[model samples]
Target: MSTNARLQANPRIDAIEQVCSKELLAQTAPHDTAPPGLSETRSDGPLSSADDVEQYGLSWETRAALEHSHCRLSLESQSGHSAHRTSMDRETSDTDGNTYPEGGLEAWLVVFGSWAGLFAALGLVNTIGTFQTYLETHQLKEYGYRSTGWIFGMYAFLTFFCGVQIGPIFDAKGPRFLVFAGSVLVVVQMITLGFCTQYWHFMLVIGVTGGLGASLIFTPAISAIGHFFNEKRGVATGIAATGGSVGGIIFPLILEKLFPLIGFSWATRVVGLICLILVLLACLLVKSRLPKKPASKENVLPDFRIFREPKFALTTAGIFFIEWGLFVPISYISSYALAHGVSSQFSYQILAVLNAGSFFGRWIPGYVADSLGHYNTLIATVALCLVCNACLWLPAGDSVPVLVVYCIIFGFASGSNISLAPVCISQLCKVENYGRYYATSYTIVSFGTLTGIPIAGEILSQCNGEYWGVVTFATCC
Candidate 1:
């Protein structure tokens, strides 16, 4: 029907009272232009007058929304109506999940929770190279690079893979239990990691425990933010994602300092303690704005069937390739530096520098995505990643400055792979089913994470320890 009729009948406007500040709404339409039809008795009548809107006991948010939708409906009628109507209809349909508070004290609290959880979750994913490098030298010294790769590869694998189930759970149950369980598991992973000495120990304790915890924490963390914001989602998601970069920088620097003094056991324990605090914040503050859907036979299981949609399928493929290229650097930069005769201190510090650039990468691209198309921003950043790998990293062997340049540039470009991917995925699906679509895409992409690191290591081995093979594989992909 007409946008005006749909706007009034829409149940979503009822939620406006919960989200909009009445004072803010009162300011949006200061002057009254009351039409004859609206009255104190009318609830969902056509807003005949702006003055009548205030008199109907409608919320300021609802009144303002009616006014705005009415104006847009008028403009579309004046212009070409069909195409605009179709687009507007699809966007505003309740099933598509467009209405969100977008801003409020409660919403920002969810953002804070997401940020803190990502710090503990993705921050460590970003720091895998540091972990890989250290374990190669110390704990897993007997293992080849290819073998050691499996431990961390599996860790990254489970991080995203588990989202297949977790995403659906988040949709049905909200984020409370998932965030809590994830927090406890990750803390245990870090604390127990300090005591690991064997290959199997690292595999079971870290590879399994850490990976699952990361998935549990991040899937809900990212999904919850979607419930509260829409127009600013790109920037907001980017802001939350910077928590990973923040964690990446801090964890490395802390480990760099503490590992030397306190040793691995105590050093890891320290990191665990810090994650405990952050994850606790996530547990307490992170919440879903949407009411939970009761479990259903149809909705309980994740529908992998969504990939039948071409747009979603293509988007998933795009992310799979971009992410395939992305993690190679994150998981191996420190090792690449050390192999080139970079000092031990600089090698450890380099991952921190990559993460430093990533901090800006996460925020800036997200801000830009709100203005530019989210997919447009993601595509550009992906291209940037390809160029950096080929031009800078492929040539720089033992050239500290070039390696530094590569780290900074690549780190920045790759940052959006995590932050913007969700925004891109959300655009293609109904908002209510966002977590499912997001998890499904990343569930496919997660296989790339599972396989990408080991393939790089194998490539490294086949090239007789040359860095170019792995770099070339990542660039070409």
Candidate 2:
């Protein structure tokens, strides 16, 4: 049958056309004329008016679905470019038949929740340098750089790697229980950190507990934002991500000041108390917009078959390389500063400076990405990271001025590495399945996070504690 005949034969399509006849006509009204039979709708005949639409006895949800589909198809056909629809076209209703509020009180509340949760989880991730420096000088002083690196590496590893299961769980069950559980683990990790004096104690609390809690919080927080946005997804995610940078900035400074005044134990407890408040807000506010699907074998399992898509595979690889070296600076900048004869005070403060720059980097690039394109913006930032590492960091030696500049430039460039990766992943799959795809990609990228720090630490040891090799390593990554 012809296309028109087939459409007419489908009862659902025929009903949709009839119910949405007026709306369809109004949408296409800008044309010089309507379709052949639409002008005769004033008369008593089929597809005549809203009265005929009501005669089909369709539910409001069904009518709404058909109306959107028919109108969208009609417009695309009129433009004669349906095959080449732009990203802007996809913005309207990109996933299944669901509609987004885009912005409303409830939607923005979700963003706030994500921001608060990330502030607590990623704040700690970003402050790893401060933690490393302190532990190296005191708790783990007897351990070699290579041995100490594994503790932090394990923390970073579980942070992203655990997303393999968390992502699918978020897709099936939503964020409520996940966020609650993650919050409890994180609070416990921070509270217990003060009491850690042994290598195994640090490993169990900071590495295992911290990593698992962070994974649960951030994965769902980022995934939930995708449910409420498409066209604006980049910026919304960026805004939420800034919470981590903010936490990075404040937490480090707080620890630095409190370390001597209050000692390590109470300082960590204070930070834990702050985390308690932030995570409580997240638990109360962060929510999933998508309806929960049934927990089933097919839905809950991780699907590696998505690698069959060449674009997705390439994206994953790019993220892997980026992540491989991304944490090196966050893990070592303080140590690098102290080794170069910078004041101990300034060494700790430099991390705050980097995170300060990151605060702007997260949201600004996100806003620009919405217009210039997510991939375009990500490429530009990654290239900037390369320049900062090679030209500024590698050559700075003991120059504080140059090192400060490197910190700012590199921090800004790397900030998008976190915010944009999820948005990019969402582009490859429907928003509903975003958690699965995002989790799977990060699951692969997790190995990079696991290895990057230890590899840098080994390079540090191999070069007799020199940082040039590590800087060069980051530049190449």
Candidate 3:
């Protein structure tokens, strides 16, 4: 049969072509273009304009191209565009058609920048144990564990809670100013932290200033990656998150050696210098994919309505428990070791060992989550953390070998909780609203961060210096 005969024979195929032409013209026209061939009298009827037929070219060659089965299928797949609309829809869809445009090099660089930024920011979070351990023995020695816990708790609280406001700000302003400002705050905190001799001083410098700096840098650093990749988001995000683990590894080792050599002040200054360099790279390379939204007071504020989604509410609860328990070991493992007669050097190194394992933990699981679902992977990791806390940390007594093992295993397992939670939240919302969702969720979770350490400290105090109470509280909480 002739090609025209085939198209004319199939009424459904003719209807599709007519619909495509009308939709294309409607989209291309400045105002609603009148339906191609309809008068007001038959406006509701199907269009059949000579202009449409002429524009589409009813020539033998054009008909042949449209009639070819392969060509027809290709044309149908690309039905919406008329070779003029170049803007690819990067928006997330309920349908599974969303994809990234610039695949390899560009996406990878964004991931790299995110990793570097996370390393400098989250690295400090992971090493909280080292700071807690050192401070408890030196500057804050007069205060009980419960009293000192407030400082770290506040730090963690600000690190996350501040993101609520910062997320919205990031979406409106882009990351450049936020990241640069954050870098400055972090450098200032590190430089000043060493000079802190009193409890209030530590709270002011590390808890408030340091926490704010971290939140500023961290929200934008991580969020910018979503602008670049969709399919490989898990792997890319994971690769970026490993920076925290790397920082965890490096910071502790540096602190351990530097503490003895130049005293705490100079040691922190050196670390601050390192963070300065890394953060500069992050500021330069890390960027948003979407144009900055116009800023307004309304847009900058977080909307709590997202909790209307049941899955997000449950996920938030899960994260709350995870964060609540997370800081215990980081804040106390060194103190536990020191109290148990382990040398100071080994005690600090324990944090490094955990972070070293975490470096791998961040990357490997991210690769896995790409194939497996992000939430599925996160749930499994959370379960693993519960096991590590229950089995390894619970039984770790005065034995160096046992404590060391616990640190490495728990460090790796918990690393996923830090890195994957944002991705899981991203999965729940549109890519554009990711900053809002992430900010809102963590704002609530920040309360957990604020009090988790102090509560653990109280548990320690209640147990008359025995760590079992603190460990049990950490496990249960």
Candidate 4:
């Protein structure tokens, strides 16, 4: 029977068979030739039957023309064939293009693991202010704010820079080993932090060890979610990122009560206990989606050629400035308040308020970013941060309410800068290479984190105790 006649006699059957055949072809196709618009077709060209074309879901005229063509089926047919081949490609291109792997108990459990891991890693970064405030008064009290700033600055630096090697390592080896090692290092650092009484000790335990632990946990924790969801990525990432905000809030409260009650060492031990629990959960749950790539020299080192893209270059610059400015406020807010005659309790509470706002800040703006455009959302957030510094923080001086308001607003606004930064970086690169891109970008930007607090500290010193110089420097950077 003619193809059209066959299709007409049992249209439903023809459609089902056509779909099945397409799926079969897709399953058998080589990966390199599987992506839509990237495949090569036969020189003999396509099937000539109008009915067959229609069965394939193409218009009659187009199908007939494609069938008659000397060249391979039109670009559209190649695209359609490609879509038919890979379920992932088809799902990704659809209206609700977001798709996840088989969803059920195991998938969600992995997400839970990621959430726990992120909570521990990012949580500490979020709570840096609490650490900074406490250390400035207790452990590192004799050091200038700028000098002590190096401790947290180095922490931030290592948190990001370690990602350079960690990303490639994760891609090659998976999260199992990485998360395990990181957990051990982080727990060790926390346990030792209570014993640290010197500058180099703080740098060794908190800066290097804590930073490495964070990088190990965070990079995989965030990257693993991409293995599970595409359409739901924004929500998943936001949910995972909230761990940081939660940690931020909890740590400050714990420190506030413990500092006066149990003293600094015990307070740190308490925080470490919390971290141990969270990190353990992370180690159990977080996993890499793709099978690990074989270890090779190519996969081991970072590729700097990505800077050839101007948009990426601009993004790196923006993140650098943001990081450069971010830690200054985090490290100095309490000191700034105390120097300006704000009450000690209020000064400490200010950091908590900032973190409280950040909880929503990380989640809401992330959802918005999925809709409004990641770069657009990021640019707006960066501007808000700048305004918070320039308008609210710059003039507050000794005003308690104004400073408190600034803390809340700025905290919320800056929260996205921390959480969404990886999302923004993901937008710029492919999923398989996300870890590498993210790690490389942050490796360069970590320099900004390293220097920012110290520079701000120096500015504070140069001003002979005023924060205006630091504020101005923050705004300018």
Candidate 5:
């Protein structure tokens, strides 16, 4: 049999030849009119008989030509699909070649987890003002203002300082155990805090223990968010960091009401219970997306070598100055109010008011930072902090109206300080090494936290309890 005869004899080859011939004709017809023989083949739709195939000049070579067209079209279609897929992948990846879901159920869930953890840890950090005021007049009344300041100073000190070690461990391992251990220490601190009356007791429970716990929880909480977001990081971190402001708002009100109803010990225990619940939620939902690194000696320890970079060193120094005065207001605002004859009931509420403004501050600047640039927004906010103190808080003296306005404006501006600092640090490093960079910067900043409050207190003492001198000190920082 001839080639056409053999092809026609085989049912499968006959079908393929017909399909390919029709497809080839349809493709060519779009751009140009079909040729005479091919036109007859197109009109018939298929070469049904061997005579039709011969008449149309549809030989084996023509059949091979049709098959080639089909293969070429398929390859082009696949190439288009492959290009589209690659474009999508590139859109999802960051500059460091890290892929993120950007925003998904899992990613948002992690944000929520970090938020809850921060609520407990940072909440206490924010409430240092209330804690300091209460301790000054009550348990530690005999101690000078500068002396009592050290307790809270130590609390803030260890909280960020330990991140030097905790950050690297988080980069190596994960958040699970670190969060759990931190949660335990924080819960223990809150539970035992009310029972402690001595100077050393407060230092041990609130200062040392609470700071360590907060460090472990704080570093991991912020770092885990880096794994799931890059583009929306500012807003997401702001949302999480607001947990602290939220805690600052609620905890003081809770203590104010509960201190009268329940007494200090049980009121604190109640706070502990709340923290326990929040940290538990964090433990369940917060997780790391990166592959685990082998916990070698180098991986587990903090390497200070990163500071060799000039930009990082400068950022760290800027943060140091920011943190130096940052805690002065947080540690002294309530006490300042009480000393100036503001009702004790309203004094505690003052911290809440500041924190309430901070609640909005934490996230709003973050959203703007996404568009304006992190460093720009941060610099503006820091400048605003200086303005609020110099223009409002410093000159207000006993004016409640001016102080309230200062609290709100300063609170809003300072809110970004906490939320954006980590983001600014993240800009200097990769997503995976975020913990180390953040911890290192804050570790240096921790010294400022350690000294800022005490320095303010000493200034207060030097000026014979006049707050202008202390306020001026904060304004300078």
Candidate 6:
């Protein structure tokens, strides 16, 4: 038969699948559960699927396993040729393993669009300290640190929390409408932030509105890139994510300088204008290549049943811990510097420095991850976070050099943590289902985002305004 010949259903494929299923079941730990919507499918005969022989390449080991299996399997052709086969199909990609263009002007443009959108969304997330410090001193000076923490924490929570519904929407409708809507909300948040004077005003404008805008922009921004790159997904995602770090570095510096000249009201409007311009570019360029699927019950609504997959469950847990530790530093470094007697001028600069390091951190880990293993890179980078917290930041009070070193090392490591997370999540499911898995994982992780900063704030309060309590909590998480 020709290489292109579509082989029909065969016993070899069926037998190999049965053996693989049995092996998978045998390998599952007692606590591990089957994946949602997948494990429940079965029959007394071969499972229903259109997969062909070539798609299920069988090797010697597969033949050996079949020999031990109960099925009567044979791979010989009519001409007496011996057959070879290996593992069953692992990925359930909707497009059946489509190849990417890798690089082109159009492809690069899409990546750039994604970068710009994430810049507005995650960049603000990275620059939360600048806002937190200013808020404490200005509009909401009477509130305790824990109360302020709740505001930012809610912002962080909505950034991911709303993604549960948005992810499935992206999978069904495409990126254009979502990006457009996000652009409007973000502009509104920025423009309105300048006028807010009360604690509730900040909560409504920055916390809730801004958070929803970010979810609308970023969820679709990240999802659109996957349609264009598969082999180089790590590098592409890393490149796009650098926008957040770049935004982090740039925005704080702008606010630090502009706050005095323009004051809070106009400075935020300036940032809003900047966001508007970039978000326009994002709306124009970021697009999905996959044909849009109609809204289905599974794709339109949030489902929590995906937790049955143990790998996904463990991955989500790892993300929760990473996020739990991640924001404590981002939200408090400026405050920490001020408390340690650092100059006010330089206190604002520290966040910029941290973000500057993260710019480089995001790209390098991604470039190398493709060559190494995705999970391997993630594990190493997360360990870097723990070390930076326990060994470096914990003892570095009032020491300029120590703070600087901590910023560069920890900033870079945490940047890798942000960029690598979705990449690792991509490994746990099919490409088409990537959004579902990513959103679900983040929905669970959002609670960490919701509580982490506030808990850290309470820790700071408990230590009589000392940062060590928060640092220790961050290290342990």
What is each predicted model's overall lDDT from 0 to 1? 0.84, 0.88, 0.80, 0.77, 0.87, 0.83
lDDT of 3 by residue, 1-477 (tens): 744454566576666665654554444444544434432223445545444445543444544444454445545455654332233443233344444543456667777877878888888877888888888788888888888899889999999999888888888778899899889998999989977888889999989998999999888888888777776677778788999989988999999999988899998998899999989888888888776777787778888888999989988888999899888888888888888999989989988888877777777777799899888888887788778878887787888888888888887788887668888888888777778888889999999989989998998888899998888877886
lDDT string for model 6 (1-477, tens) is 432231235555545555554444344423344333233344333332334222334333644454345333333332234333211111123246665566667888999999999899888888899999999988888999999999999999999899899888888888899999989999999999998999999999989998999999988888777777776788889999999999999999999999999899999999999999999999999988777887779668887899999999999999999998899999999999999999987999999999988998888999889889778998998899899999999999999899999999999988987678888888777777778888889999999999999999998888899998999999998
Candidate number of the best lDDT: 2
Candidate 4 per-residue C-alpha lDDT over 1-477 given as tens digits, one digit per residue, 9 for 90 to 100: 665675456554444444443444445446664545222342444333464345445555644443344323333244365443354443442133434653445666777887777777777877787788778877788988777888888898998888889887877777898898988887888789889999999999989999999988877887777667665566667777888878878788788878889988888888889889988998888887677777888887778899998877888888998899988887788778888898887777777788888888888888888888777887898899899899999999999889989888888888887667878787777777878888888888999999998898888889898889999998887
Off by over 4 Å in 4: 1-99, 102-107
Q: In terms of TM-score, how similar is model 3 to the real structure?
A: 0.80
- Score every model by TM-score: 0.81, 0.82, 0.80, 0.79, 0.84, 0.80
lDDT string for model 5 (1-477, tens) is 565665656575566656666566556543443456553445556655657656644565765576566554554344464554454553467787888777877888999999999999999989988888888888898999999999999999999999999998999898899999999999999999988999999999989999999998999999899888888899999999999999999999999889889888999999999999999999998899988899998888988999999999999999999989989988899988888889999999999999999999999999999999999999999999999999999888778999899999989999998889999999999888988899999999999999998999999999999999999999999
Q: TM-score order of candidates, best first? A: 5, 2, 1, 3, 6, 4
Where does candidate 1 stray beyond 4 Å? 1-97
Instruction: Point to the candidate with the largest TM-score.
Output: 5
Per-residue lDDT value at 420 in model 4: 78
- For each of the candidates, give the backbone clash count: 3, 0, 2, 3, 0, 6
Scored against the true structure, residue 437 in model 4 reaches a CA lDDT of 82
Residue-level lDDT for 452 in candidate 6: 98
List model 1 lDDT by residue over 1-477, tens digit each.
543454455344533422332333344433474333322223454334345445745565665574455544554554454574764443322355357766667888888999999999988888898889999999898898899888888998899888888888888888899999999999999999987899999999888999999999999999888887788889889999999999999999888889889999999999999999999999999898677888885665889889899999999999888877778988889999999999999899999999999999999999999999999999999999999999999999999999999999998999987889999999887777888899988899988888899999999999898988999989977
Q: In model 4, how large is the Cα lDDT of residue 278?
A: 86
lDDT of 4 at 192: 90
Structural RMSD, model 3: 8.9
Error of 2 at 296 (Å): 1.0
lDDT of 1 at 468: 89
Any residue pairs clashing in model 1, and if so which?
A: 34-49, 35-48, 35-49
Per-residue lDDT of candidate 2, residues 79-198 (tens digit) = 466544543344457547766667667879999999999999999999999999999999899998888889999999999999999999999999999999999999999999998999
